[model samples]
Structures are given as structure tokens and as C-alpha cells.
Target: MSAAIRNYALVTGAYWGFTLTDGALRMLVLLHFHALGYSAFEIALLFILYEVAGIVTNLVGGWLAQARGLRFTLFAGLALQIASLTALSLTNPDWLPALSVAYVMGLQAASGVAKDLTKMSSKSAIKVLVPANADGALFRWVALLTGSKNALKGVGFFMGGALLSWLGFSGALLAMAAGLALTLIAVAISLGSAMAGPAGGIKPKFRDVFSRDRKINVLSAARLFLFGSRDIWFVVGLPVFLASELGWSHIEVGSYMALWVIGYGFIQAIAPKMLRAKTREPDGRTAQIWIAVLIAVSAAIAAAITHDIAPELAVLGGLLVFGIVFAINSSLHSYLILAYAEGDKVAMNVGFYYMSNAIGRLTGTVLSGVAYLYGGLVGCLVTSIAFLTLAWVISAALPSRSGASTQS
Candidate 1:
């Protein structure tokens, strides 16, 4: 392989590991806290802490990525993840566990921003080599990487759950710690050999590039908001609801989640074709239209989930519906962000895009908590339906492929 290829592959592998470890933690989260006797409100509080920390990190992380380059930022983030996970594993006491976990949550949030910076920066560096016709290819790559990573993390969760059943929380924590340590080691080595040099700083001059182009900026902002809402519901609200309401075990839940990701990965593979089939002009509006349709459908499906449904059937049905929604919407969202963004300010554009999603996440968690408290499943369903409606309307407002103007 060429040196560039080798380097890129190593970085990709590092990200894959990073994702796997993160997924493992996510899969175990509700169960872990529940084991520690945390209530739904407490869970929301922890999630809020996590998002609050992310808000702070997003700003600093963007600046760090601008100054230190994507690779350095990613590495630093990985380091923080390592320490944070280790700390989290050690602190599981009833009284102090939540507070300790919150601190770790903050670190995890910081790592999230750093990781986003790294992924986008790496993609930018390699964009020149990729085919121009590949509008959603980068998003496809991310989905593939993340999906596979989560699949592996599912394995980790399965093992952890079994171990927790047999050997208790300590054993589960040990296994998680081991996996994260290995991932950290792998990323450290990859960064050493693949991305040791100084990274290029962000270009502030291009920050206003979008502002100068009002049409694209407006479209981009709208798209970002729509996507932000989509992510918050999918990532924060859905998982918690299933776990709490359906009494699903982590292993069972992970299996369903794995299926969701499988469906998503399959859609990502065909995202290019989906876009092409939707439009002859190739302006990528095809992707957006499909995304809108899927988001609306997913919201509808999520709203219909209730305790009267069989656990197995509910999981499968919900997974299938939400899976389709997530796959199409996520792919299109990535394509839109990249399309609207200037090459010079790719990092910031990507960061801002994520920050928007983070904002939505913050809102979703709070709302979901309130919804669960009052109306139970109905509240969760309503929130999702509202967001999806907003997304669909915004997408309908966007200009067609042929008539679309330059997005900054």
C-alpha cells in the first residue's frame, strides 16, 4: 500500500476501535446505572451532565482542532477517554457514583468533539483522492466504520452483561476497562506512526464563506437544525425508552440495536444509488428527499410503540422502522453538511454541524425525561413526531436539485 493509504488505514482502524469502545460503554449505560439504583430522572441528569460537558468541549475542541490539527485533537481526546473510562470503572458506589460518573461524562463529551474533528479532518485530507461522483460516500464510510465498531461493541456488551450476571459489576467494569485500554493502545500506536506531524490550523477566513452566501447558509442552517432534532431523538430518547419500558436486558437490547445498525449500514451502502435514482441532475436533493420521508416514517413508528406489544416483536418492529429512518436521514445529513461546507473551513463546518446536533441532544434528553414522567410512552412519541414533522417541512422547503444554488 502507498504511505498515504497506510496512514489513512491506520487512522481508520484507530477510529474503529475508538467507536467500538464507546459503543460498549453506551450499551451498558442504562443497565449499569439501574444496577446502581439510579432512577429515570437520575439517568436524565447524567445524560444532561454529559451534554452540558459537551457544550463546553465543542468550543474548545474546535479551537484545538484549528490550532493543533485533527490528528492531535483526536489523540488528545482518546487520552482523555482512557482516563475517564478508567475513573468511571472504579467509581460505582451508590452515594458518590453519580457525581464521579458526571466528571467522567464531561471527559467523554470532550473526547466526542475531538473525535469529530479528527474524522472530518481525515476525510478532508483524503477527499481529493475519492471520486467526485461520490456525494454520500464519505458518510457511507463513517456509517460503515461506526456500524462495524458498534457491532463489535455489542459483543463487548453481551460479554459484559453476562459477566455482570456471573461476576458482578466489578467484573463488568474490568472487562470494559480492558477493552478500552486495548483500544487506547491501538490508537496511540496508530497516531504515532500515522499522524505524528503537526496538523494544519483552521482557516478563519473561510468562517464567513457561508455567511457571504445567504441562500446556502439558510439552507445549511435549516438542514443542520433538522438533522440535529433527528439525532437527539434517535440517540438519546429511543434507547432509554426501550430499556425502561420494555424491560429488555442489555443483551437483548444490544441485539436489537445491532439489527438497527445493520439496517442502517445497508442503506448507507445504497445511499449513492438512492440519490442517483431520485434525481438525474445529481445535485444531491435526492438524498434529502429520502431522508425526509424516512424521518417522518421513523417518528410514526416510534410513536406507535407501547407496552401492550410483545417485547420481541416490539423490538424487531421498532428497530426495523427506526433503522430505516436513521440510515437514510443520517446519510443525507452527512452529504448535505459536506456539500454546503467550503473545503477551507471543513473542520469548523463539521464541528458546527455536530454542535447543532448536540444542542438538540441536550433538549431531547430533558424533554424525554419530562415526557416519561408525565405521559410515559406517549410523551416520548409526541416529541419524536414533532421533531420529524419539523424536519420534513424544512426538507420540503429546500430547492430542487436543478434549481439549487451554491451552498457557500
Candidate 2:
């Protein structure tokens, strides 16, 4: 394989491993702590630091990666994750509730920082490695990377439950740490003397990561609400509903969510062909249209629950449609960010975009518990609709075409 392809494989593989553990860690914490009688809001609080840290991590990690090289950021992220896992594994179940919460939140913050660092490194590499003039290749490659990463994350969700069952919480965490450690070692050895992506050589000022480009700024706004809409319902409401009302076991809830995410990822992988990006790339107009459709789907789900139809059937069926449609939206946004990114500062640009993403997740994560506690799934879906509406409004401002201020 060519050096570019080989390095891309290594970066993708490393992030795949990181994402697996990241997904599993989320499941393990949610399920284990909930089983320990943590309230939904309290459970949500545990993750607050995780999302909060991502906000800072993505913004700064991008600059660090650009200044120090992608390899530096990637390795630092991997090490931090391993440390976070190992530290969390030592949680003492007998501790006071407040103490336990504090401990886990601190570790989760570490994991969050690790996650953004690794993500910014891997994703920024794509624009650097893929030729800008290669018609349609960038979109296809981005879809594959993003889709496959989500698919593995779904598997990790299932694995989390399985591991928790087979080996208690501490055991499951340790196992994941061990596996990730091996992954880190492999990447470190294989990538010796090779740069994962071009580094700026000079440190970017903090303010420099903030993009002023209209297309990028507009797209970032749209992306914020787009992800917020998904997580507002997806994070706490869905699995909690499946478990509490549906009376499903932890494993069953995990498995169903795994299935949903797997299917979603599948659609994303094929989105390039499905959306006909080869014939014409998706633009701001496309994003607006798709978000509108998603709003309708979300509203239908909310209405079905309100009217007390076969609520489960309606939710399940409607969600399948939502996943397929959302995947297209997500895949489009993923490609657009890279397309709009200024070439010279790809890492910084990607970082700033994801900072907005982290903010949205923070909003959704908080609202997931609040909305679900008050109105259950219906409340969550309604809130999601509101977020999507905002996204559609914001996307209306996106440039209708695909030429960006690119750098080589």
C-alpha cells in the first residue's frame, strides 16, 4: 500500500479501537450506576464533565496537534484514555454516592479530553491525505471512516453489557484498558518516523481555531442542533425507556441500541451512493431539506406516543426511518466540514467545528434527563424536534455550493 493509504489505515484503526472503548465506557457507566439506583438526572450529571471537557479539548487539542504533529496528539489521547479507564476501574462501590459521583466524573473528563484529541487527529488527517481535486473521493472516504467508526461503537455498546455480565464493572473496564493499551502500542510502533498528518510546525493561537468563514460558521451552527436533536432523545431517554417501562434487561437494552446504531452506521457508509454525491455533492440546500424531513419524522414519533398508539411499535418503526435519514444528514455534515475547512489549518478547523458538536451534546445530555423525567419519550422527542427546527433554520444560511477556501 502507498504511504498515504497505509498511514490512513493506521489512524483509522487506532480511532476504531478508541471509539470501541469510548462507547463501552458510556454503556458500562450508565447501566452500572443506574442499577445502583442513580436517578436519571444524577446519571446525566456524571457525564457533564465528560462533555464539558470535550468543549475545551477539541479546541485546544487541535492546536496542539497542529503544532506538535498528529502523532503527538494521537499518542497523548491514547495514553490518557488508558489512564482514565484504569483509574475508573478502581471505583469503590461502597463509597458515598456523592464521592462516587465525583470520582467517576473526574475520570470521565479525562476520557472526554482523550476522545476529542484522538478524533481531531484522525479526522483532520483525511483532508491532508486525500487529494482535494479527487472528485467525490473525499466524501466517500469520510463516509466510510465515520460510518465504520459508529458501527464499531455500536458493537462496543453490546460488548459493554456482555462484559458487565461476564465480568463485573471493574473487570470490564480493566479488560477494555488492556485491549486499548495493545492498540496504542501497535500504532506507536508502526508509525515510527511517519507523520500522520501535516503539522503547522508553529503553534496556532487559541483564537485562530475559531473560523470566520461564512460557510464554515453557518455549517457549524447547523451541526450543533443536528447532533443535539439526536442525543436529546438518544442518550438517556431511549435506553432508559427500554429498561424502565419495557422491563428489558441491561443486556437486552444494550443489544437493541446496538442494532439501531449498527443499522444507522450501515446507511451512513452507503450514503455517498444513496445520496448520489457522485452526480452532485450535497450542499446547504440539501442539509436544510434533510433536517426538515427529520423534524417531521421526530414529530410523528412524538405524536404516536401522545396518542397512545402501539407506542412501542411506533417508536421502533419510526426510529428505523429516523436512523436512516439521520445517517444521511450526519454523513453530509461530516463531508461538508472537511470540504469547507481551510486546507492549511485542517486540524484547527475540524477542531472548532467539533467544539460546536460537543456543545450540542452537552445540551442534549442535560435535556435528555430533564425531558425524560417530565414527559418521558414524548418530551424528549418534542425537544429533539425543537432542536432540529433550529438546525434547519441555521442550515438555510449555508452556501449552496461546495467551493471552499482550501489549502494544500
Candidate 3:
């Protein structure tokens, strides 16, 4: 038991380090390119390859992890990120816009692969580390890992903006890369020689990436739209809107977004308590309820903005509610996917699940720029509402309880 606890802590810490760099990278690229007078849609284009790479990474990352062990995958992910950051540090700001975009896109794709590999490995480790007989322990541990991860990522966003403000683009990338390199060293030393695999030790096949479980499939589908709803507005639309339409400086924009993600993480950390998971675990009905509520909240925000009723307040204040609701929904979905994963093949299941997540982000990233360019924040919100509605419908089909057995 003590060994399990130690390993869990180590894996969680590694996740935190990786997520911090990942979040900062996003903010750095988005703000740096936007500052160069790139259009909104163009800014979105900068991240398109990032999501595309995620789709590919998740497809095979699980098989690699199951075969090689979690520590190997985790190490590989951190190393890749460091490499990507170093390469990006050499970007010459004086180059042609098209050339700069191409260079950044290719690097961003590498970072994307790094991000998912780290995520899949860390998440799968939880199943291996936690004893199966520990009822509801899975949800709590998952929440803590994910919640703390997002909070750190929020801090990273602020760090990115601050670094860019103080150090310039090239210098900021170099600084972050240096810090992450240290993190990788620390994790490598602390993790030592244990290349942990799942408790059941089942080897994963490439074909296992396509889920056979109905519950996993339904949850993955719902997850696709649920995340899409957020990124459609979040990735490019809202940040660009605040910067351009509202005339916010980079610092102000970064700070607000940072606070939002931080608070959202807090909500996620407490979601199990809020939902009273101690009394009864969340199931399909729980998902259905939260998602339906999210749909309503999204609609109200859109309507308020459309009516021009304190437009700024409507968007700002209403989004607070959105963040709160969305956090719970996401935390719930995270738990559900793990719950659905068979113990012998946790890596495979999580990999399949995040593949859907990456796809949704890709879709949303593409739309964020286009929507903001044409219809503004209101347009983004309306599209988000549609995505939420689709998620609700898909979530309704999820089994009230996961088909996976507690003992596997």
C-alpha cells in the first residue's frame, strides 16, 4: 500500500510538471503570434497541427506504454517537449509571416504528441497504483491528479504571459525549456528503475485502440462534444475577443484566463464532494443532468450577450457560471472513462478515450477563429451551445453503471 502511494505521488508530480509546460506553451504561441499582427483565424491555424498530432499520438501511445511501461512513455513525453521548446526558441521573428507560421506549426505538432503521451501514461498509472478493492478511491485520486494539474497549468498561463512580457518570445521559450529540462531530470531520478505497467499486466494490441465497450464509446462521444464546446470559444475566440474587442493588454487577458482555469480546477477538485460521490457514484444519469444544466447555462450567456444587456458583464459574469458547471462536467467525464476501463487494459482504454478528446479540440480550434472572425463572441457561444446539446444527447445513452467490473 505504501509503495502504491509513493508511486502515485511520483506520477502525479510528473504530470504537474508536464502540464505546466504544456499550458505555458499554448499561451506563449498564441500571444506571440497574435502580437505579430496575425489575424484571429490565422492564430487558430497555429494550433491546428497541435491537435492533429494529438489524434495520432493517442492512437498508438497506449500500445507503446503497455509494451514498454509507463515510465518510459512519460520520460519520452517530457524529453520530446523539451526538444520542441528548444527548437521553438530559435524562431526568428524577422522572418516572413508564412514561414514563421509553418515553422511554429511543425513544432507545435511535436509538442502535441508530447502532451498526450504524458497524459496517457500518468492517467494509466493511477489504475496500476491504486488497489482495486479500494472503493471510490479511483475517483478521488483521479480528481486530485487532474485538479492539481489544471491549477498548475493555470499558473503556467500567467507565467507565459509574464515571461513574454519581460523576456521577449525567443528568451521566454529558452527559459521555459531550461526549467522543463530540470523537471525531466528530477522526475527521472525520483522515479528510479521501476517501469510500472498495469496491475493485470495484459499486453495491448493496436486493434484495442478502437474501444469495444459500449459505455466507453458513448462516454467518448459525449466527451468529444463536451470539450469541443469549451475550446470553440476558449482556444482562440474568447482570448482574441478580450484582446481586440475589449482592448485588454496581453497581461490582463492572460491573467483573466489564468484565473478562470484556476477556479475551474478548484471546482473539479471538489466535484466528487459536490456530487456526493461518497453516497453513490456518478453514472449516466448524473452525466445527463450536469450536461443538460451546462446547455442551459451556455444558452443564457449567449442570449444575454445577444440582447446587449451589460454586454461585458453578461459575457464575463455568465462565463463564471459556465466555468463552474463545465469543470464538474469534465471531472465527471474523466472519472467515467477510468471507471469504464478494464483493469487489464487501462492504458488502451484511456488512449482511445483521449483520442476523442483530441479530435474535439481540433474541431473547436478550427472553428474558434472562423466564428470569431465572422460573428464574434456571441457566435462562439451559440456554436458552443450546439455542441453541448449534442453532448447531452450522446451522454444519455451511457450505461447507468460502467460495464467494467470493479475486480476486472
Give the poorly placed runs of model 3, Cα more than 4 Å off. 34-42, 165-167, 193-201, 240-247, 403-408
Question: Per-residue lDDT of 235-344 in model 2, one digit per residue for the tens?
Answer: 88998888988788976876888989888888999999998888787778888999999999999988888999898888889989999999999999999999888777
Predicted candidate 3 versus true structure: per-residue lDDT over 232-283, tens digit per residue: 9997788887888789997788789899999999889888888888667888
Model 2: how far residue 88 lies from native, Å: 1.9
Best by TM-score: 2
For 296-351, candidate 1 gives per-residue lDDT tens digits of 56555554565454644654576576666565566556555555555555555555
Question: In candidate 2, residue 49 scores what lDDT?
Answer: 92
Scanning candidate 2 in windows of ten residues, the lowest lDDT window is 399-408
Error of 3 at 19 (Å): 1.6
TM-score of each: 0.75, 0.93, 0.92
- RMSD (CA, angstroms), candidate 1: 4.9
- The segments of candidate 1 whose C-alpha lies over 4 angstroms from its true place after superposition are 92-143, 146-156, 159-220, 223-255, 273-284, 295-319, 372-379, 396-408
